[model samples]
Target chain A: MRKIKQWTAMGLATVMAMSLSACGSGKTAETTTAAPAETTKAAAAETTTAGATTSTEPVELKFSWWGGDTRHAATEEAIKAFQAKYPNITVTPEYGAWTGWEEKQSLNILGGNAADVMQINWNWIESYSQGGKSFANLEDYSDVLDLKQFTPESLDLCKVDNKLMAVPISLTGRLFYWNKTAFDEVGVALPTDLDSLYKAGEAFKAKDPDMYPLALGEYDRMILMVYYLESKYGKNWVEDGAVSYTEEEVKDGMDFITGLEEKHVIPTLATISGDMADSLDKNAKWIDGKYAGIFEWDSSASKFKKALEGSVNKPGQEFVVGEFVKMGDNNGGFTKISMAYAVAGNSKHPKEAAMLINFLLNDEEGVKIGSTERGIPCSAAGLKILQDNKLGDPLTIEANTKVMNYSKFTLDSKFEHNDLKANPDGVYYKVFGKLSSKELDSAAAAKELIKGVTDTLEN
Target chain B: MKSKGMRKFLAENAGFFFVLPWLIGFILFKVYPFASSLYYSFTNYDLFNGVTKTGMMNYNKIFTDSDITRAFMVTFKYAIFDVPLKLTFALFIAYILNFKLKGVNFFRTAYYIPSILGGSIAIAILWRAVFNTDGLINAVVTAFGGEKINWMASANGALFVIIMLRVWQFGSAMVIFLAALKGVSEDLYEAASIDGAGKWTQFFKITVPLITPVIFYNLITQLCQAFQEFNGPFLVTKGGPNGATTLISILIYNNAFLRHKMGMASAQAWILFLIVMTFTAVAFVSQKKWVYYSDEDGR
Candidate 1:
C-alpha cells in the first residue's frame, strides 16, 4: 500500500512537471510576441505625421537575420544605436544560428509574419522573387537611397532585372588559409599556383604520414577551387549560354580531386565528414602542427586566427593567408554579395521601413554600428566608415582590395534562374566527391549528376 | 427519468469536456495538418506560392528518385538491425534488475539517464566525439596497436554507429518489462521450482509466456520509434559521407523546407506513415499466436 501511494505521488509529480513545461513554452512564445509589439508600436508612432509639419511618429520594425553570437551582439548594439538616434523609431531584432535560418524564414514568409526587413542570401533571391509579389522594389525609393555610394560590383548583386531589390552588406571571396607555425616547422614555403599547392601538400604528407595536408571539408569548396582553376585555364564550365556540363569537363574535374584522394594527401572521406571538428581542436592537427592549410572564406580567417591564439595546448602558434590565387595579376577571383537586407512587401509602413534601412546602411552613425557585423558594409559611405574605424581584419581588407582591383562589375550570375531548382554547388560537390573518393567511379558519377540535374530541370 | 437520461448523456460525453484542450489541439495541430498534408501530397505546393494541383507527379518522381530509394533502404536497414537488438538488450537488463540486488535503483537510474537525453543535441555531439576517426574509440584502438579506423566516413561504419546509438537508449522498454515482471505472482516461480524446472526452464516456460503481451507491446512501440528516427542521423552524421545515412525523415525535411518542395515532402511523409502502419499491422497479426493474457479464460 505504501509503495502504491509512493508510485501515485511520483506519477502526479510527473504530470505536474509536464504541465509546467507546457506553460513555460507558452510564456516564452508570449514574451516573444510582446517584445515585437513594443517595437512595432514605437515604429508606428515615429511614422505618424501631424498637420502642416512632418512630425516624426514613433515607428517600430522587426528585422531578422542568422549569424553567430558575435554577429548577434553586434547587430543588437547597432539596432539600439539606430533607435537612439531616431528617438521615435524602435527596431526589434530576431536572429538564430545558420543551420535552421532558411527553413524558419521561409515559414515566417508563408505565414505572413516575417519581419518588415530581413537579411537574405543571394541563392534565395531567385526563389523568393519567383514566389511572386513578396518583396517591395527598392527602386521606388531611389531618392532616399544613395546607390552611387556603393561599388558598382556590390550594387549589381542587389539589382534584379536592372532594378535594385535589396541592399548588399558585404563583398566576400574565398581564399586559402594555413597554420604559419605548422608550415615553418615543416620547412615548406607556401604554394602560389595549383601545381605548387599540390607539391606543398605532398611535402607536408612526406613530413608526417599520419596528418592530412589539406583540411578539405565539403565538396563544394573543392568544386569551387576546381572551377577557379578551370576559369584560370580559360574554361567556363557553367557558361552563361548552357545549363548542362559537357562530359569531358565533368571528367576533368572529377579526376583532379580523385587523383588527390588516390595519393592520400586529402583526409579519408570519413575523417572529412565525421571528425572535422576534432581534427581542428588545438590538441589535434592545428595544435600539434600536423595539417598545413584550409580553403575558407575571408570571414573565417578571423576564426582560424582566434583558434590558434586561444589554444592552451599549442604554445607560441601563429597562422596567416599565403598569396591567394587571382584570375591573373590583372584579373580578380570571384566576388559576390554575401548577404542583403530587404523590406517585406506586406509591411504596414514600407516607406518608414525603407528609411530605417537607409539609416542602417548610409548614415555615418549607422555605418559605424554596422561595420564588421554586416561584413564590410556594401555602401561606399559604409566602407569609408569602416576604413576610418579600421574595423575589419587586415586579411579581409586585403582580400576586398584585391577583389576591387581586378574583378569586373558582376551581378550574382550563379545560374540564379535555372529551372533546375538545384543548387549546382551541392550537386557538383556530392557527385564529384563521390567520384573522387572512388566511392563512385567517373562513369557512375557522371550518370548520377546528369540524372539529378535533368530531373531538377524537368521538375 | 428524463433527468436521469440527460445525466447519462452528460456522463457519456464527459470525457470530451475533460480532454477538451487535448481534443482542440489534436484537431488544430494534428488533424488539420494531416488533412492538409494529404491534399498537398498531390499538388505542386511551394509554401510561398501556395498549393496548385499537379496530379501525381511528386509521388511518381519518388518512384524514380535515387535519393529516395537510398533513404528508404537506409531506414529499413536501421529498423531491421536496431529493433531486435534493442529488444533483446532491454529484456536482458530488465531480467537482471528483477533480482533483489544492492544498488539496483542506482543502476536503473544510470541506464535511464541516457534515454532521457537520447534525443538531445548534446548526446548527438557526444556520439560524434566517440565515433569520429581520431575520436576516443579510435585512440583506444590505436593504443592497442590497431590501425585507426574512420568510423563516420564510410557508409557501413556510419550506419553501425547510428544503430548502436539507438540500441543504447533501451531504458524505456526495459522499465516497462521490469514493471511487468514485478506484477507476475511469486507463487508461480515457486510452483515451477517444485515441478523440478531449472532457472532457464522456469524463465522460458513461466516468465516468458506470462510476459509475452508486454514483449508484443514493446516490439510495436520500438519499431515505430525506429522508423521515425531522425535526430540521431541528422545531427550525428548529417546524412553524409555520400548520403549514406539519409533517412526518410531527413529526406522529407529537405524536400519540404530546404528545397521548398512541400508537396513532395508531404507525399514522402505519407509514404512513411503507410510503411509504419503496414509493419505495425503485421506485428499485431503475429501477436495472436504467441501473446498470453491473464484474462483469456474470461474472454
Candidate 2:
C-alpha cells in the first residue's frame, strides 16, 4: 500500500510538471488561434447575413479583411450583396481593425485554415509566397475573374516567381496633410516647402509651448527619413535588395528627423509616448488640431479627416491636403499597391473566391457599394463605374492624384519586412526611438539602421 | 507460469484503463510539443517555410546577439523588482485581513477581482490609460500641482508601469497568504503575548516562521510566472522607449510570430526555461534554511 501511494504521487508530479511546461507551446497556440477567432467572431456577428437559398448544393466561402468601421461597413454590405446574387454560395465574413491583424492572418494561413478570400497587404505576396505557392494564382481563375480590368503594370506588382498571386486594389503613397485651421490660428501659412515647415514650427512653438506643428511615430519617422534621403540622392532607399545609401547619407536622413524635433516641427518621441495613443489618428492632440501636420497614406486621409470632424477648429477646413514638401530637387516618396484580394492556395472554392473578388472589384453594383473605401479601385471597370456616378471621397481622390503625380521612387518589397518595420523591436522602431529620445547620436543610429536593413535583406 | 503471472498483474491494475484517456492527451499535447520545442531550438523552423536543420545556429545567435543580451537584462530587472514587492504587499494585506473585522470578506473579494482581470488585455489597456501623460494618474498629479511625468517614454518609467501592473495583481498570493495565516495556531500568539511581545514581534516570531512553507511555495510559483509574463509589456509599452520593457517573452514572441524566426524563438524559450528552473531550484535549496514544518521528520 505504501509503494502504491508513492507511485501515484510520482505520477501526479510528472503530470503537473508536464502541464506547466506545456503552457509555452499549448497556451501560445491557443492564444494565437483564439485572438483571431474572438475578433472575427465579434465581427462576424456584426456582418452575419440570412440570405434565402435558391440552389440545392450550397458552397461556403470565408472572406477576411482589416480596416476602420467605414471599410468594415462597406465590405459587409458588399458581401451581403454577393451572397444575395449567388444564392448557391454562402460567404462567411471575418474582419476587424488592423491591430495584430497580420499576426493572426499569418498564423491562419500557416495553419491552412485562412479565409478563402483575403484582403492582403502588398508585401505579403513577397513575404508569404517566397516560393510562389502560398496564394492561388489569380491568372488561373481568369475565366471567372476579370483580369483585363487591371493594368498589366499593376498586376505585375503582385507577381512573385511568375505567379500572379493577387490583383491590386489601389495604389497609394504617403503625402503631407496639414490642419489649415491650426496653421491659420498660429498666423502661419501651411508649409509647402521644408524651409517654411521649419519656420512654421518655430512660430507655433512661440505661440504655445504645449502645441507642435506635427507628430511622427517611429514608423512614420522611418518612412519620412527614407523620403528625405531619396529626395536628396534621387535613388531608391534600397536597390537590388541592398542598402543603397552610405552611412553618412543615412545619418543625414536621421538628422532630418531629429532636426524636426529640435526645431519643434514635430513632437519628440518622449512627448508622443507620453500621449500613449497607439496611432496618430487616435491621439487626442492630433484629433484636436494641436499637432497640425501628418505624413500619411493617401488612402487613409478620410479617416484622419473624420477624426477631426468634432475639433474646435472649423470642421471642414481641419484636414487640408498640403502640397509635397520641396525637400530636394527629386520627388521623394514611392507608390505601391495599397492592398489586394487573393484566394488562399488551400481554399476549397478557388473559383467562387475568384468570383467574389471580381464582384467586389469589377461588378458595377459591388464597385458602387465599395466606392473608394479601399482607395480608388485599380480596376478600370470599377474606376469607370465610380467616375460615371461622380462617386468617391473628394479628399481621398485629391490626395491620390497628388501622390500619383509626385512620387518617383519604387517601394522595395524589403522596405515593409516585419523585422524592419514591426513596432518596438524592429529596426525602424529601435533606430528612430533611440535617436528621437537622444539615447544614440545620429551617426550611431544611422549605422544601426543600415545594419538592420542589411540583415533583413540577407534573410 | 510467466503468462499466468502477467495476466494476474494486469487484472490487479485494471483501474489503469480509467486514466488512459488522460495519459494519451498528456503525451500528445504536453509531451510532444515540449520535446519538439527542444528539437526546434536546433533548426530553422519558420511556420510557413518547411523546417531546415541548422544545428547550433539559433543557440549561437542567442548568445551573440546584443538584443538577446538586452532582453535578458530587462527580464531580470523586471523579475527582481516585481517578485519581492508583490510578495511583500500580498503578505501585508493578508496579515491585515486575517484579523476578525467587519466586511473582511467583501474586501477579500474586491482584492481578488484584480487577480482575475489583471492578466487580461482589457486591464492592460486600462493600465495604459491610467498611466498616460494625460491619463488619470497625471490628472491627479497635476491637481496636486506636480509636474506630469512621461511614464511611457522614459526607460525607467516604462519598466515601472509594467512592474507595477504585476505587483498590483497580488490578490492570488494574498489569498494564499490569508489561508496560511489562518492555519497558524492562535495559541502561539497567546503565548507570545503572555511573554509581553508586541504585535509585530509576535508576527515575526510566531506567525511568520509558521507560514514559511507557504511563503516558499508562493515564492517559487510567482517567480516562475514573472519570468513568463508577456501581455502587460506587449500591450502597454510594447517594449518601447528604446526597448526598456522588452522582456524575454516579448522577444520570443516577436521572433516567432512577427519575424517568423521560430527556431530562434524556440532557442529563446528554452533559455527562459533554464533560467526559471535555476531560480526555482535555488529557492528550493534556500528554503531548507528558512521554512519550518510541524512534521519535520516526515519532511
Candidate 3:
C-alpha cells in the first residue's frame, strides 16, 4: 500500500512538471501568433488597390533571406524605403546567417506559415518545387516581371522545363584571388595561364622554402578548383556530352594536386585554418599576407576585401579576378543560377506576394534597395541603379562586369552526383571528402562516389 | 476462492500500474520508432519521397562500402581505447574522493561540472579550440619549447583527443563509485586493519569486492554512452583528417538528415543497436563471475 502511494505521488509530480513546461511553451507560441496578427492587420489597412483613387487595403508581406549582418541591415533599409514609396504595402523583413536557415524555412513551410517571399538557393529549386509543392509558377505574372531586362542566361537559370520558378537576385562566378604582396616578394607577376600559375607557385616556393605558395582548405572547394583546372586544360572531366576520362586521367588530376603538396607549393591540409567566418575575421591568414592565392566567388569578394582592409598589418593587398582556369582545351566552367526569391504557392495572398517580389527586383526604388544588399541585382533595372548609385563594393562591380564580359554559362557535371533527390545537400562532400585524404585510392574512390550517387539517383 | 484469484492478479501485476506511464512512453516513442526503423531498413526511404521496399540492398551495400567500414572501424577503435582509459581514470578519482578530506564536496562539484555539460555544443567548441593547430594545447606545447602537434588533424591524433574528452567527463561514474564506497562499512576496514592488512590490501579485498556491483553498472552504462558519442567527433574533427573519426552514429546522422537517406540511416542505426546490445550482453554474462551482491542468495 505504501509503495503504491509513493508511485502515485511520483507519477503526479511528473505529470505536473510536463504540464508546466507545455504551458510555458504554449504561452510563447500564443504571444508570437498574437503579435504578428496585430501588425498584419495594421499593414493590411494601408495596401492600395490597383486602378482605384484611394489605395487598396494595405497588405503586409513578410520577406526572409539569409546573409551577413551588413546584408541584413541593408535589406532592412530597403524594406523601409519600399514602405515609404508604397505607403500601402508594409514589408516585414526577416534575415539570418546561412546556418539553420534551411531548417527554419522547412518548419515554416511545413506549418503553412512560410513568409510570403523567401530567398532560395539554386540547388534547392527542384527540391522545394517538388517536395513542398509550395512555389507558384511565375509564367502568368510575366507582365510585371520584365524578364527581358535580365540576361537570357540568367533568366533561363530560374526556369525549370519552361516554367518560370523564381527571379535570380544575383550572379556568382568563381575567380582566382592572388595576394599581391606574396607574389611581388617572390618576383612573380600574376599568372595568366595555368602553366604560368604553376611556374609562379614554384618560383614562390623557391624564394621561401618555409612558406606554402598556396593555402587551400581541404574541403569541397579544393576539389572543385581541381575540376576547374581540368576543364581549363581542355578536359571536361565530368561535363555532359564530353568524353568522360579514363581512370588514368582522373588519377593524373589527383596526382597533380598531390605533387603540389609534395613540393611544398601547397600547404598541408593541417595549415589551412578558419571557416568562412574565420576567414573573414580581422587577423585571418588570408587577409594578413600569409597565403599567396585563394579561389573565391565574386559575391564574397566584397567581404574578403573588407576583411583585408580591416587587417592590422596591411600588406599591399590587391584582387585580380581571372577566368576560371582551363586545363587542356575547354573554356567553360560550371555556371548555374545563384540564389532566387520565390513566393510560396500555398500563400493566401499570391498577387500581393508577386507584387512585393516585383517591387524588390524590378521597380526603380526597389532596384536601389537591392543594389545595396542583394548581390549584384538580377534585373537590368537593378543593375542600372547599382551602376548609377555606385552602392556596391568597387571590386564586386569590376568582378561582376568581368564575368559578364568573359564567362559562358555551363552545367555542373557533378550535378547528378548531388544527392538532391535524397539528401538535399548531397552526400557528395562526405563521400569525396573521405577520398581526398587517400582513405581510398583513385579507382576505389571513384567507385564509391559513383555507387553513393547512383544509389540515391536510382532510388 | 473467486476473490482470491482477483487478489493474486493485482499483487502479481502491481508494478505495471506503477510504471504505466513509462510503459506507454516506451511503446509510443521507443518501441514504435524501433519497429518502424526495422521496416525502413528494408526500404529506400528518402524522407522527402517517403519509403519504397528495397530488400537487403542497403545492408549488402554496407559490407561493400568503404565509408561504412571506416565508420565501423573508427567507432570500434574509439570504444576500445576510450572505455578502458575512462574506467581506469574514473576508478582512480572515485577512490581519491572517497577519502575524508577538507571541502570534498566542493572538489566533487568542480569535477562534476564537465559531466553536466558533456555533450553540449559549448564543450564541443571548446574541444576544437583546445585541439586546433593554432589552439590552446598546441600553444602550450609550443610555449614549452616543443613542436606543436596537430591533435585534430590526423586520424590517430583525432581519436586520441576524443578519448581524452570522454575520459575527462568521468565525474558521474566517480560519483556513483563514491556512493558505493560509502556503502562499504567502516567495520570491514577496521577488521582488515586488526588482521594487520595494509591500506592497499584492505582496498583490493574488502572495498572493491563490496562495490563490484556498482562498478559493473557504471561500466555498462558508460560503454553504451561512449558508443553513441556523436557530438565530439562530429563537431571537433567533423569526422575527418581522412574520415578517421567518422563513427557509425555520425554516418547515420549524415545519411538521415544531411543526405535524407532515411532507410540507409535506419539500417545503420539498427546495426549500432545490435553492436551495443551484444556488448551489453557480454558484460552481463561476465558479471556473474565478478559482481558481488551484498545479499548473497544473489537475488
Q: In terms of TM-score, which candidate is strongest?
A: 2
lDDT of each: 0.69, 0.85, 0.67
Model 2, span A340-376: residue lDDT tens: 9999998988877887898889888889999999998
Question: Which portions of model 1 show Cα errors greater than 4 Å?
Answer: A1-55, A130-132, A151-153, A161-163, A232-237, A276-289, A325-333, A404-426, A450-459, B1-24
lDDT of 3 at A446: 50
What lDDT does candidate 2 reach at residue B141? 98
True-vs-predicted CA distance for residue B183, candidate 3, Å: 2.4
DockQ of 2: 0.35
Could you give candidate 1's per-residue lDDT for residues A1-459 as a string of tens digits? 644444454455556556745764521121122222222223323221211111366566888888877777777777776566556556677788876788788777666777888888876666675533566787676555555666675666666667666778777666667777777776777766666667666777787776655666544344443445455454443444333456655555556566565665466555566663522433256555566676655654566666677767676777777666443333324556778888887887666667667767776666666667656667777777778877766767775665555444233244332232222124654675566457787667756666655545444
Model 2 Cα lDDT, one tens digit per residue, B43-143: 99988776867799988888898877898889999999999999999999999999999999999999888999876778867887899888999999999
- For each candidate, C-alpha RMSD in Å? 5.9, 6.3, 5.2
Q: Sorted by TM-score, highest first, which candidate order results?
A: 2, 1, 3
